[model samples]
Target: MQRLPSDPFTSPLWHFVAVLGINGETGQLRPAHHFTGILAGLIYTARAVVAEAALPSQDRAAMADLPERLAAIRKAWLCKSSYAPMGYVLNLLLYGKKIAFETGSRLAVVWNRDGTLLYFQGRPLAMETIRQLIASMTADAEDLLWDGLLFRPRKAEAEAEAGSSSGRRKGLGLLEREGRFLIPLATIRDDLTQTQRGQSFLHTNGLLGKEKEML
Candidate 1:
């Protein structure tokens, strides 16, 4: 299982991507993308986001309002969500888990229960959409989504009893425990930022936004 490579800045016009989290001082943002190599929009921090990355040369006109637009979106996400920028590792982990659980494993558009914030609207994340995108990758693209891999029919059957017989788990006649089982994987800030493809995989994919914990 692996994330497909994605380059979202193809269009001359700026492509809008929602933010998942951010650091206030630095221009870094946690971009929202599915398995399109953006870390499921779950918990990967991106490098600085700018229209300049999309354009071959710096076209001032194309990026004139990028800063203002980014600021506005970041502000909105911070106000309504539980993610805090740069420092709080706990908030980052909770938010990531919440998104993955609610969205059922694919990195798609997610919102708070109140409907004030929306995520990954740029691509409209869904199973079919994800399947189509993966097919576009290569002839033998494998699904790298954590949840899909975790709950696959055969894999689940094989690993249902993988862990200790008494460990807590998710779907197997009240006895299923596999892979991570009860051991929490996300304990520090680095856990959220770490990626199988290396830190570079966390880049914003040429879109934008992040912020502080409000809940």
Candidate 2:
């Protein structure tokens, strides 16, 4: 299929299936596994690095066999393809069941509008995990400080030193709950209320997010 640069969706985007605030986060939203989120970024970055033949040899080998379905979904998403509805794609991409044994209230996480306050397995991540995630995302993570919400680079005495690449993303994040505060196309849950077969898909596949279109 030809790649579509932008969405052609003229109708309402997607049905608000999942009930929000049942836990804490509001509105019907997609919940992709954190690992899958990382993979999405990795593949996006790698595709470019590889095109330039700049990807490291070791990482290149690791990506030899890209997940076909996952890659396909990512393409659809990156291109904002109207033909490939992201709401359906998110359900398809979440690698939930493979990690189903870990599926519990503790495994289910949520986030707020601005992506500041976060809860994992129903609680804030431990300090060490947050530190680790910060470290993974940046080289100057040591210069960063957290103040209950999000991390920010420290203000160094020297102007040049203070503006260092502390905010740079060295790589995709490990654990982050980042998504938008979406307004669903409709206030409907019939798609979810109608069945447990879908729930079975969640168990067997223990899964798994969108946007852009107008005129």
Q: Could you say which candidate leads in TM-score?
A: 2
**Cα-based lDDT for every prediction:** 0.37, 0.40
Q: Which model scores highest in lDDT?
A: 2
Cα lDDT of model 1 by residue, 1-215, tens digit: 11112332332211322333442323576432322233323233321332233322557566677677666544433322423231132343456556655665454566546554444643334555565556446212222322355342325444344233343133333322323222123532344655566455235332223111101
Residue 71 error for model 2, in Å?
16
- For each candidate in turn, the TM-score is 0.16, 0.18
lDDT of 2 by residue, 1-215 (tens): 22223442332322221222133434334343443443354445645643434434567566755556446645555333334334333433444334533554444666756666666644565555676677556434433322222343223332243233463332112112221122333543344564645353233321221222110
After superposition, the stretches of candidate 2 with alpha carbons farther than 4 Å from their true spots are: 1-32, 54-124, 128-215
Task: For residue 124, give model 2's deviation from the true position in Å.
Answer: 7.6
lDDT score, candidate 1, position 205:
38
